[model samples]
Target: MNGANMSARLKDKIICITGAASGIGRATALLMAREGALVVATDLQADTGAALAGEITQTGGRAIFLQHDVTDEDGWREVIAIIRARHGRLDVLVNNAGIGLSGPVVEMSLADWRRQTAVNLDGVFLGVKHGLPLLRQSGGGSVVNVSSIAGIKASANAAGYCATKAAVRQFTKAVALECAAAKDNVRVNSIHPGIVETAIWDSLIGTTQGARGTRLEALTAPSIPLGRTGTVEEIAAGILWLASDESRYVTGTELVIDGGRSIA
Candidate 1:
Protein backbone atom coordinates (compact mmCIF):
# COMPACT_ATOMS: atom_id res chain seq x y z
CA MET A 1 0.00 0.00 0.00
CA ASN A 2 1.14 3.52 -0.65
CA GLY A 3 2.24 5.59 2.31
CA ALA A 4 -0.53 8.15 1.83
CA ASN A 5 -3.25 5.54 1.49
CA MET A 6 -2.09 3.32 4.31
CA SER A 7 -4.24 3.35 7.41
CA ALA A 8 -3.02 5.19 10.45
CA ARG A 9 -3.31 2.15 12.66
CA LEU A 10 -2.18 3.88 15.83
CA LYS A 11 -3.65 7.27 15.13
CA ASP A 12 -3.37 9.61 18.10
CA LYS A 13 -2.03 6.88 20.37
CA ILE A 14 0.55 8.06 22.86
CA ILE A 15 3.46 5.64 22.58
CA CYS A 16 6.61 5.44 24.70
CA ILE A 17 9.64 3.55 23.48
CA THR A 18 12.77 2.94 25.56
CA GLY A 19 16.27 2.68 24.05
CA ALA A 20 15.14 4.51 20.98
CA ALA A 21 18.43 6.17 20.13
CA SER A 22 19.11 3.62 17.44
CA GLY A 23 18.58 0.09 16.13
CA ILE A 24 15.17 -1.62 16.44
CA GLY A 25 14.02 0.94 18.97
CA ARG A 26 14.68 3.82 16.60
CA ALA A 27 13.05 2.02 13.70
CA THR A 28 9.96 1.27 15.81
CA ALA A 29 9.68 4.87 16.95
CA LEU A 30 9.75 6.14 13.37
CA LEU A 31 7.21 3.57 12.24
CA MET A 32 4.90 4.35 15.16
CA ALA A 33 5.11 8.05 14.40
CA ARG A 34 4.20 7.38 10.77
CA GLU A 35 1.12 5.60 12.01
CA GLY A 36 0.02 8.85 13.67
CA ALA A 37 1.12 8.14 17.22
CA LEU A 38 2.81 10.74 19.40
CA VAL A 39 6.07 8.99 20.25
CA VAL A 40 8.21 9.60 23.29
CA ALA A 41 11.63 8.21 22.33
CA THR A 42 13.88 7.60 25.33
CA ASP A 43 17.51 6.53 25.62
CA LEU A 44 20.78 7.19 27.42
CA GLN A 45 22.25 8.78 24.30
CA ALA A 46 20.72 12.19 24.59
CA ASP A 47 22.16 13.56 21.36
CA THR A 48 21.16 10.63 19.20
CA GLY A 49 17.70 10.41 20.74
CA ALA A 50 17.13 14.09 20.11
CA ALA A 51 18.26 13.65 16.51
CA LEU A 52 15.78 10.83 16.04
CA ALA A 53 13.00 12.95 17.47
CA GLY A 54 13.98 15.75 15.13
CA GLU A 55 13.93 13.41 12.17
CA ILE A 56 10.42 12.29 13.01
CA THR A 57 9.21 15.83 13.57
CA GLN A 58 10.73 17.00 10.30
CA THR A 59 8.83 14.27 8.55
CA GLY A 60 5.61 15.81 9.91
CA GLY A 61 5.30 13.28 12.72
CA ARG A 62 4.89 14.05 16.41
CA ALA A 63 7.70 12.93 18.70
CA ILE A 64 9.83 14.00 21.65
CA PHE A 65 13.09 12.73 23.13
CA LEU A 66 13.71 11.93 26.80
CA GLN A 67 17.05 10.92 28.25
CA HIS A 68 16.33 7.76 30.20
CA ASP A 69 18.18 4.96 31.88
CA VAL A 70 15.67 2.12 32.01
CA THR A 71 17.58 0.38 34.78
CA ASP A 72 16.81 3.26 37.14
CA GLU A 73 13.47 3.23 38.93
CA ASP A 74 13.48 7.00 39.38
CA GLY A 75 14.08 7.47 35.67
CA TRP A 76 11.01 5.42 34.86
CA ARG A 77 8.94 7.40 37.36
CA GLU A 78 10.01 10.70 35.83
CA VAL A 79 9.21 9.44 32.32
CA ILE A 80 5.74 8.20 33.27
CA ALA A 81 4.98 11.40 35.15
CA ILE A 82 5.94 13.45 32.13
CA ILE A 83 3.73 11.30 29.93
CA ARG A 84 0.82 11.67 32.31
CA ALA A 85 1.26 15.40 32.56
CA ARG A 86 1.70 16.08 28.87
CA HIS A 87 -0.49 13.45 27.23
CA GLY A 88 -2.49 12.31 30.28
CA ARG A 89 -2.42 8.72 29.00
CA LEU A 90 -0.25 6.14 27.33
CA ASP A 91 -1.47 3.78 24.65
CA VAL A 92 1.61 1.66 24.13
CA LEU A 93 4.88 0.88 25.87
CA VAL A 94 7.74 -0.81 24.00
CA ASN A 95 10.44 -2.16 26.28
CA ASN A 96 13.08 -2.09 23.55
CA ALA A 97 16.21 -1.04 25.40
CA GLY A 98 18.71 -3.82 26.09
CA ILE A 99 22.37 -4.88 26.07
CA GLY A 100 24.34 -7.91 24.88
CA LEU A 101 26.91 -9.65 27.07
CA SER A 102 28.24 -12.73 25.36
CA GLY A 103 30.69 -15.26 26.81
CA PRO A 104 30.78 -18.78 28.18
CA VAL A 105 28.90 -19.00 31.50
CA VAL A 106 32.04 -20.05 33.39
CA GLU A 107 34.10 -17.29 31.80
CA MET A 108 31.55 -14.56 32.39
CA SER A 109 31.94 -12.43 35.48
CA LEU A 110 29.08 -11.95 37.92
CA ALA A 111 29.23 -8.19 37.37
CA ASP A 112 28.87 -8.62 33.61
CA TRP A 113 25.94 -11.00 34.01
CA ARG A 114 24.20 -8.65 36.42
CA ARG A 115 24.72 -5.67 34.14
CA GLN A 116 23.17 -7.49 31.23
CA THR A 117 20.29 -8.63 33.39
CA ALA A 118 19.71 -5.13 34.69
CA VAL A 119 19.33 -3.68 31.22
CA ASN A 120 17.58 -6.53 29.43
CA LEU A 121 15.35 -8.02 32.15
CA ASP A 122 15.05 -5.63 35.08
CA GLY A 123 14.44 -2.69 32.76
CA VAL A 124 11.43 -4.36 31.18
CA PHE A 125 9.98 -5.20 34.59
CA LEU A 126 10.31 -1.60 35.65
CA GLY A 127 8.75 -0.33 32.43
CA VAL A 128 5.73 -2.53 32.93
CA LYS A 129 5.48 -1.65 36.59
CA HIS A 130 5.46 2.09 36.00
CA GLY A 131 3.81 2.20 32.58
CA LEU A 132 0.84 -0.04 33.43
CA PRO A 133 -1.04 2.59 35.40
CA LEU A 134 -0.99 5.09 32.55
CA LEU A 135 -2.13 2.37 30.20
CA ARG A 136 -4.94 1.42 32.54
CA GLN A 137 -5.89 5.07 32.74
CA SER A 138 -6.01 5.23 28.97
CA GLY A 139 -8.85 2.70 29.28
CA GLY A 140 -6.78 0.08 27.44
CA GLY A 141 -3.40 -0.37 25.75
CA SER A 142 -0.70 -2.75 24.64
CA VAL A 143 2.77 -3.57 25.98
CA VAL A 144 5.35 -4.94 23.55
CA ASN A 145 8.42 -6.32 25.26
CA VAL A 146 11.28 -6.94 22.82
CA SER A 147 12.74 -10.28 23.68
CA SER A 148 15.30 -12.18 21.57
CA ILE A 149 15.15 -15.37 19.55
CA ALA A 150 17.71 -16.60 22.05
CA GLY A 151 14.91 -16.56 24.58
CA ILE A 152 13.52 -19.67 22.89
CA LYS A 153 16.78 -21.27 21.84
CA ALA A 154 20.08 -21.67 23.62
CA SER A 155 23.37 -20.28 22.38
CA ALA A 156 26.65 -21.72 23.63
CA ASN A 157 28.15 -18.38 24.65
CA ALA A 158 24.99 -16.35 25.23
CA ALA A 159 23.69 -17.96 28.39
CA GLY A 160 23.07 -14.75 30.26
CA TYR A 161 21.33 -13.02 27.35
CA CYS A 162 19.12 -16.03 26.74
CA ALA A 163 18.15 -16.36 30.38
CA THR A 164 17.05 -12.76 30.68
CA LYS A 165 15.02 -12.92 27.47
CA ALA A 166 13.30 -16.08 28.64
CA ALA A 167 12.37 -14.24 31.79
CA VAL A 168 10.83 -11.49 29.64
CA ARG A 169 8.71 -14.04 27.79
CA GLN A 170 7.27 -15.41 31.04
CA PHE A 171 6.92 -11.98 32.57
CA THR A 172 4.91 -10.86 29.57
CA LYS A 173 2.50 -13.75 30.00
CA ALA A 174 2.05 -13.19 33.70
CA VAL A 175 1.29 -9.51 33.18
CA ALA A 176 -1.02 -10.33 30.32
CA LEU A 177 -3.02 -12.63 32.55
CA GLU A 178 -3.09 -10.09 35.32
CA CYS A 179 -4.45 -7.38 33.05
CA ALA A 180 -6.96 -9.76 31.53
CA ALA A 181 -8.31 -10.92 34.88
CA ALA A 182 -8.65 -7.35 36.02
CA LYS A 183 -10.39 -6.52 32.74
CA ASP A 184 -8.19 -3.48 32.50
CA ASN A 185 -8.06 -3.86 28.72
CA VAL A 186 -4.29 -3.78 28.68
CA ARG A 187 -2.65 -6.46 26.58
CA VAL A 188 0.93 -7.70 27.01
CA ASN A 189 3.03 -9.57 24.45
CA SER A 190 6.69 -10.19 23.64
CA ILE A 191 8.48 -9.84 20.29
CA HIS A 192 11.38 -12.18 19.63
CA PRO A 193 13.67 -10.69 17.00
CA GLY A 194 16.42 -12.75 15.48
CA ILE A 195 19.67 -11.33 14.13
CA VAL A 196 18.89 -7.84 12.97
CA GLU A 197 21.24 -5.25 11.49
CA THR A 198 21.62 -3.00 14.51
CA ALA A 199 24.26 -1.46 16.73
CA ILE A 200 23.73 -4.23 19.29
CA TRP A 201 25.94 -6.45 17.20
CA ASP A 202 28.83 -4.08 17.75
CA SER A 203 29.19 -5.28 21.32
CA LEU A 204 28.53 -8.89 20.39
CA ILE A 205 31.27 -8.92 17.77
CA GLY A 206 33.56 -6.31 19.35
CA THR A 207 33.51 -3.95 16.37
CA THR A 208 31.36 -1.09 15.12
CA GLN A 209 32.35 -0.67 11.49
CA GLY A 210 34.65 -2.04 8.78
CA ALA A 211 35.14 -5.79 9.27
CA ARG A 212 31.76 -5.97 11.03
CA GLY A 213 29.96 -6.94 7.82
CA THR A 214 32.26 -9.90 7.21
CA ARG A 215 31.90 -11.01 10.81
CA LEU A 216 28.10 -10.67 10.69
CA GLU A 217 27.77 -12.62 7.46
CA ALA A 218 30.10 -15.34 8.74
CA LEU A 219 28.04 -15.48 11.92
CA THR A 220 24.58 -15.65 10.30
CA ALA A 221 25.21 -17.84 7.23
CA PRO A 222 24.60 -21.13 8.99
CA SER A 223 22.59 -20.00 12.00
CA ILE A 224 19.83 -18.08 10.24
CA PRO A 225 17.76 -20.29 7.95
CA LEU A 226 16.78 -17.33 5.84
CA GLY A 227 20.48 -17.17 4.82
CA ARG A 228 20.56 -13.56 5.95
CA THR A 229 20.07 -11.30 8.93
CA GLY A 230 16.74 -9.60 9.58
CA THR A 231 16.27 -5.87 9.32
CA VAL A 232 15.22 -3.49 12.07
CA GLU A 233 12.22 -2.45 9.97
CA GLU A 234 11.08 -6.05 9.67
CA ILE A 235 11.04 -6.40 13.46
CA ALA A 236 9.45 -3.00 13.84
CA ALA A 237 6.56 -4.11 11.67
CA GLY A 238 5.78 -6.92 14.09
CA ILE A 239 6.06 -4.55 17.02
CA LEU A 240 3.67 -2.11 15.31
CA TRP A 241 1.12 -4.87 14.84
CA LEU A 242 1.27 -5.84 18.48
CA ALA A 243 1.02 -2.23 19.60
CA SER A 244 -1.96 -1.44 17.40
CA ASP A 245 -5.59 -2.62 17.67
CA GLU A 246 -4.90 -4.96 14.76
CA SER A 247 -3.61 -7.40 17.32
CA ARG A 248 -6.23 -6.65 19.95
CA TYR A 249 -6.99 -10.33 20.51
CA VAL A 250 -3.32 -11.25 20.82
CA THR A 251 -1.91 -11.29 24.34
CA GLY A 252 0.48 -13.39 26.40
CA THR A 253 2.09 -14.48 23.14
CA GLU A 254 5.51 -14.18 21.52
CA LEU A 255 5.71 -12.68 18.05
CA VAL A 256 8.89 -14.15 16.63
CA ILE A 257 10.29 -11.98 13.83
CA ASP A 258 13.37 -14.02 13.30
CA GLY A 259 14.54 -15.07 9.84
CA GLY A 260 13.28 -18.57 10.54
CA ARG A 261 16.30 -19.01 12.78
CA SER A 262 14.64 -20.12 16.02
CA ILE A 263 13.05 -23.10 14.29
CA ALA A 264 16.25 -24.02 12.55
Candidate 2:
Protein backbone atom coordinates (compact mmCIF):
# COMPACT_ATOMS: atom_id res chain seq x y z
CA MET A 1 0.00 0.00 0.00
CA ASN A 2 1.83 3.07 1.24
CA GLY A 3 5.56 3.40 1.90
CA ALA A 4 5.42 2.90 5.66
CA ASN A 5 3.10 -0.06 5.36
CA MET A 6 5.02 -1.69 2.51
CA SER A 7 8.30 -1.12 4.31
CA ALA A 8 6.99 -2.96 7.32
CA ARG A 9 5.65 -5.93 5.36
CA LEU A 10 8.79 -7.98 5.79
CA LYS A 11 9.71 -6.88 9.28
CA ASP A 12 11.66 -9.42 11.30
CA LYS A 13 11.64 -12.08 8.56
CA ILE A 14 14.71 -14.23 8.03
CA ILE A 15 15.83 -14.14 4.39
CA CYS A 16 18.84 -15.89 2.83
CA ILE A 17 19.92 -14.69 -0.61
CA THR A 18 22.53 -16.08 -3.00
CA GLY A 19 24.64 -13.88 -5.31
CA ALA A 20 24.43 -11.07 -2.82
CA ALA A 21 27.74 -9.57 -3.92
CA SER A 22 26.33 -7.53 -6.79
CA GLY A 23 23.53 -6.91 -9.25
CA ILE A 24 19.97 -7.93 -8.41
CA GLY A 25 21.15 -10.05 -5.51
CA ARG A 26 22.83 -7.08 -3.88
CA ALA A 27 19.79 -4.94 -4.38
CA THR A 28 17.50 -7.56 -2.90
CA ALA A 29 19.75 -8.03 0.11
CA LEU A 30 19.86 -4.31 0.87
CA LEU A 31 16.17 -3.75 0.31
CA MET A 32 15.10 -6.73 2.34
CA ALA A 33 17.41 -5.70 5.17
CA ARG A 34 15.95 -2.23 5.12
CA GLU A 35 12.53 -3.83 5.32
CA GLY A 36 13.52 -5.30 8.73
CA ALA A 37 14.56 -8.76 7.64
CA LEU A 38 17.54 -10.55 9.13
CA VAL A 39 19.36 -11.07 5.84
CA VAL A 40 22.10 -13.64 5.29
CA ALA A 41 23.94 -12.58 2.12
CA THR A 42 26.16 -15.02 0.26
CA ASP A 43 28.24 -15.04 -2.93
CA LEU A 44 31.64 -15.95 -4.35
CA GLN A 45 32.78 -12.36 -3.92
CA ALA A 46 33.63 -12.48 -0.27
CA ASP A 47 34.75 -8.91 0.12
CA THR A 48 31.80 -7.42 -1.70
CA GLY A 49 29.35 -9.68 0.04
CA ALA A 50 30.79 -8.81 3.41
CA ALA A 51 30.73 -5.17 2.43
CA LEU A 52 27.02 -5.38 1.73
CA ALA A 53 26.44 -7.04 5.05
CA GLY A 54 28.48 -4.32 6.69
CA GLU A 55 26.39 -1.62 5.06
CA ILE A 56 23.23 -3.23 6.36
CA THR A 57 24.66 -3.58 9.83
CA GLN A 58 25.84 0.03 9.76
CA THR A 59 22.29 1.06 9.11
CA GLY A 60 21.14 -1.00 12.14
CA GLY A 61 19.74 -3.82 10.07
CA ARG A 62 20.45 -7.46 10.87
CA ALA A 63 22.73 -9.16 8.37
CA ILE A 64 25.48 -11.74 7.92
CA PHE A 65 27.78 -12.38 4.98
CA LEU A 66 28.88 -15.87 4.01
CA GLN A 67 31.29 -16.84 1.27
CA HIS A 68 29.32 -19.14 -0.97
CA ASP A 69 29.76 -20.84 -4.31
CA VAL A 70 26.28 -22.08 -5.00
CA THR A 71 27.51 -25.02 -7.08
CA ASP A 72 29.23 -26.54 -4.08
CA GLU A 73 27.10 -28.95 -2.04
CA ASP A 74 29.43 -28.60 0.94
CA GLY A 75 29.00 -24.85 0.75
CA TRP A 76 25.23 -25.20 0.71
CA ARG A 77 25.44 -27.48 3.74
CA GLU A 78 27.48 -24.90 5.59
CA VAL A 79 25.08 -22.13 4.60
CA ILE A 80 22.16 -24.07 6.03
CA ALA A 81 24.06 -24.82 9.18
CA ILE A 82 24.85 -21.18 9.72
CA ILE A 83 21.25 -20.21 9.18
CA ARG A 84 20.03 -22.81 11.63
CA ALA A 85 22.58 -21.89 14.25
CA ARG A 86 22.05 -18.16 14.00
CA HIS A 87 18.41 -17.53 13.15
CA GLY A 88 17.06 -20.91 14.29
CA ARG A 89 14.69 -20.57 11.33
CA LEU A 90 14.58 -19.47 7.73
CA ASP A 91 11.60 -17.69 6.29
CA VAL A 92 12.78 -16.95 2.78
CA LEU A 93 15.44 -18.01 0.26
CA VAL A 94 16.28 -16.18 -2.96
CA ASN A 95 18.22 -18.27 -5.44
CA ASN A 96 19.88 -15.54 -7.50
CA ALA A 97 23.31 -16.88 -8.41
CA GLY A 98 23.65 -17.33 -12.17
CA ILE A 99 25.92 -17.05 -15.21
CA GLY A 100 25.19 -16.62 -18.91
CA LEU A 101 26.77 -18.38 -21.89
CA SER A 102 26.08 -16.67 -25.19
CA GLY A 103 26.91 -18.75 -28.23
CA PRO A 104 24.86 -20.50 -30.84
CA VAL A 105 23.89 -24.01 -29.79
CA VAL A 106 25.90 -25.66 -32.58
CA GLU A 107 28.97 -23.65 -31.69
CA MET A 108 28.55 -23.92 -27.92
CA SER A 109 31.11 -26.00 -26.03
CA LEU A 110 30.37 -28.69 -23.47
CA ALA A 111 32.20 -26.65 -20.85
CA ASP A 112 29.95 -23.64 -21.52
CA TRP A 113 26.80 -25.71 -21.04
CA ARG A 114 28.13 -27.31 -17.89
CA ARG A 115 29.22 -24.04 -16.39
CA GLN A 116 25.89 -22.37 -17.02
CA THR A 117 23.95 -25.33 -15.69
CA ALA A 118 26.16 -25.74 -12.67
CA VAL A 119 25.61 -22.22 -11.44
CA ASN A 120 22.25 -21.30 -12.89
CA LEU A 121 20.31 -24.55 -12.64
CA ASP A 122 22.22 -26.73 -10.22
CA GLY A 123 22.55 -23.86 -7.79
CA VAL A 124 18.78 -23.51 -7.64
CA PHE A 125 18.39 -27.23 -7.03
CA LEU A 126 20.86 -27.15 -4.15
CA GLY A 127 19.20 -24.13 -2.61
CA VAL A 128 15.83 -25.81 -2.56
CA LYS A 129 17.21 -29.13 -1.40
CA HIS A 130 19.05 -27.66 1.56
CA GLY A 131 16.78 -24.73 2.38
CA LEU A 132 13.64 -26.84 2.46
CA PRO A 133 14.30 -28.30 5.89
CA LEU A 134 14.99 -24.90 7.39
CA LEU A 135 11.91 -23.43 5.76
CA ARG A 136 9.82 -26.30 6.98
CA GLN A 137 11.15 -25.85 10.46
CA SER A 138 10.16 -22.21 10.28
CA GLY A 139 6.56 -23.25 9.71
CA GLY A 140 6.81 -22.30 6.04
CA GLY A 141 8.56 -19.68 3.93
CA SER A 142 9.09 -18.56 0.34
CA VAL A 143 11.70 -19.45 -2.31
CA VAL A 144 12.28 -17.08 -5.18
CA ASN A 145 14.28 -18.40 -8.13
CA VAL A 146 15.63 -15.79 -10.52
CA SER A 147 15.08 -17.02 -14.04
CA SER A 148 15.29 -14.93 -17.23
CA ILE A 149 13.17 -13.80 -20.15
CA ALA A 150 15.38 -16.14 -22.16
CA GLY A 151 13.80 -18.96 -20.18
CA ILE A 152 10.42 -18.19 -21.71
CA LYS A 153 11.36 -17.18 -25.27
CA ALA A 154 14.14 -18.19 -27.61
CA SER A 155 16.96 -15.73 -28.06
CA ALA A 156 19.70 -15.75 -30.67
CA ASN A 157 23.11 -17.04 -29.51
CA ALA A 158 21.99 -17.82 -25.95
CA ALA A 159 21.10 -21.46 -26.07
CA GLY A 160 22.87 -22.63 -22.94
CA TYR A 161 21.72 -19.70 -20.85
CA CYS A 162 18.18 -20.13 -22.10
CA ALA A 163 18.13 -23.83 -21.39
CA THR A 164 19.38 -23.38 -17.83
CA LYS A 165 16.96 -20.59 -17.10
CA ALA A 166 14.11 -22.64 -18.56
CA ALA A 167 15.05 -25.48 -16.29
CA VAL A 168 14.99 -23.13 -13.30
CA ARG A 169 11.49 -21.98 -14.18
CA GLN A 170 10.16 -25.52 -14.40
CA PHE A 171 12.05 -26.61 -11.33
CA THR A 172 10.53 -23.79 -9.36
CA LYS A 173 7.04 -24.80 -10.41
CA ALA A 174 7.70 -28.43 -9.62
CA VAL A 175 8.96 -27.56 -6.16
CA ALA A 176 5.97 -25.32 -5.56
CA LEU A 177 3.61 -28.15 -6.41
CA GLU A 178 5.42 -30.54 -4.14
CA CYS A 179 5.31 -28.08 -1.26
CA ALA A 180 1.64 -27.42 -1.88
CA ALA A 181 0.81 -31.10 -1.87
CA ALA A 182 2.72 -31.55 1.34
CA LYS A 183 0.92 -28.52 2.78
CA ASP A 184 4.25 -27.20 3.89
CA ASN A 185 3.31 -23.53 3.47
CA VAL A 186 6.46 -23.06 1.43
CA ARG A 187 5.95 -20.89 -1.65
CA VAL A 188 8.29 -21.53 -4.57
CA ASN A 189 8.24 -19.24 -7.61
CA SER A 190 10.43 -17.77 -10.34
CA ILE A 191 11.15 -14.24 -11.55
CA HIS A 192 11.96 -13.66 -15.22
CA PRO A 193 13.82 -10.41 -15.71
CA GLY A 194 14.67 -8.82 -19.04
CA ILE A 195 17.72 -6.68 -19.68
CA VAL A 196 18.49 -5.16 -16.31
CA GLU A 197 21.38 -2.73 -15.78
CA THR A 198 23.39 -5.13 -13.66
CA ALA A 199 26.91 -6.52 -13.87
CA ILE A 200 25.42 -9.76 -15.12
CA TRP A 201 23.86 -7.93 -18.04
CA ASP A 202 27.09 -6.04 -18.75
CA SER A 203 29.14 -9.22 -18.69
CA LEU A 204 26.72 -10.93 -21.04
CA ILE A 205 26.24 -8.17 -23.62
CA GLY A 206 29.12 -5.76 -22.97
CA THR A 207 31.02 -6.79 -26.09
CA THR A 208 28.05 -6.77 -28.39
CA GLN A 209 26.61 -3.88 -30.42
CA GLY A 210 25.89 -0.61 -28.53
CA ALA A 211 28.43 -1.66 -25.93
CA ARG A 212 30.39 1.59 -25.94
CA GLY A 213 27.63 3.82 -24.57
CA THR A 214 26.70 4.51 -20.96
CA ARG A 215 25.53 1.48 -18.99
CA LEU A 216 21.93 2.66 -19.02
CA GLU A 217 21.71 3.46 -22.72
CA ALA A 218 23.87 0.56 -23.80
CA LEU A 219 22.19 -2.23 -21.91
CA THR A 220 18.60 -1.12 -22.59
CA ALA A 221 16.18 1.75 -21.90
CA PRO A 222 15.60 2.04 -25.68
CA SER A 223 14.82 -1.49 -26.86
CA ILE A 224 11.84 -2.26 -24.67
CA PRO A 225 8.26 -1.03 -24.53
CA LEU A 226 8.91 0.41 -21.09
CA GLY A 227 11.60 2.62 -22.63
CA ARG A 228 14.25 1.54 -20.09
CA THR A 229 16.03 -1.42 -18.73
CA GLY A 230 14.61 -2.60 -15.41
CA THR A 231 16.52 -1.28 -12.47
CA VAL A 232 17.88 -3.56 -9.72
CA GLU A 233 15.62 -1.72 -7.28
CA GLU A 234 12.55 -2.46 -9.37
CA ILE A 235 13.33 -6.15 -9.48
CA ALA A 236 14.12 -6.12 -5.77
CA ALA A 237 10.73 -4.60 -5.10
CA GLY A 238 9.05 -7.54 -6.76
CA ILE A 239 11.20 -9.89 -4.71
CA LEU A 240 10.24 -8.11 -1.51
CA TRP A 241 6.60 -8.57 -2.33
CA LEU A 242 7.13 -12.26 -2.99
CA ALA A 243 9.05 -12.68 0.26
CA SER A 244 6.51 -10.85 2.37
CA ASP A 245 3.24 -12.14 3.69
CA GLU A 246 1.50 -9.93 1.16
CA SER A 247 2.07 -12.68 -1.34
CA ARG A 248 0.77 -15.37 0.99
CA TYR A 249 -1.64 -16.77 -1.54
CA VAL A 250 0.77 -16.55 -4.47
CA THR A 251 2.88 -19.52 -5.47
CA GLY A 252 4.01 -21.67 -8.38
CA THR A 253 3.97 -18.67 -10.76
CA GLU A 254 6.56 -16.91 -12.89
CA LEU A 255 6.71 -13.16 -12.33
CA VAL A 256 8.11 -11.51 -15.47
CA ILE A 257 9.81 -8.14 -15.00
CA ASP A 258 10.80 -7.77 -18.65
CA GLY A 259 9.42 -4.35 -19.62
CA GLY A 260 7.11 -6.07 -22.08
CA ARG A 261 10.05 -7.18 -24.23
CA SER A 262 8.64 -10.65 -24.62
CA ILE A 263 5.59 -9.17 -26.34
CA ALA A 264 7.66 -7.19 -28.79
Best by TM-score: 1
Residue-by-residue lDDT tens digits, candidate 1, 110-145:
999999999999999999999999999899999999
**Candidate 1, 85: how far from true, in Å?**
0.4
lDDT of 1: 0.93
Q: Give Cα-based local distance difference scores for all models.
A: 0.93, 0.89
Task: Give the per-residue lDDT digits (tens) of candidate 2, residues 120-158.
Answer: 999999999999999998999999999999999988888
Candidate 2's C-alpha runs over 4 A off are 1-6, 207-222
Model 2 TM-score on a 0 to 1 scale:
0.93
Deviation (Å) of 103 in candidate 1: 1.0
Off by over 4 Å in 1: 1-6
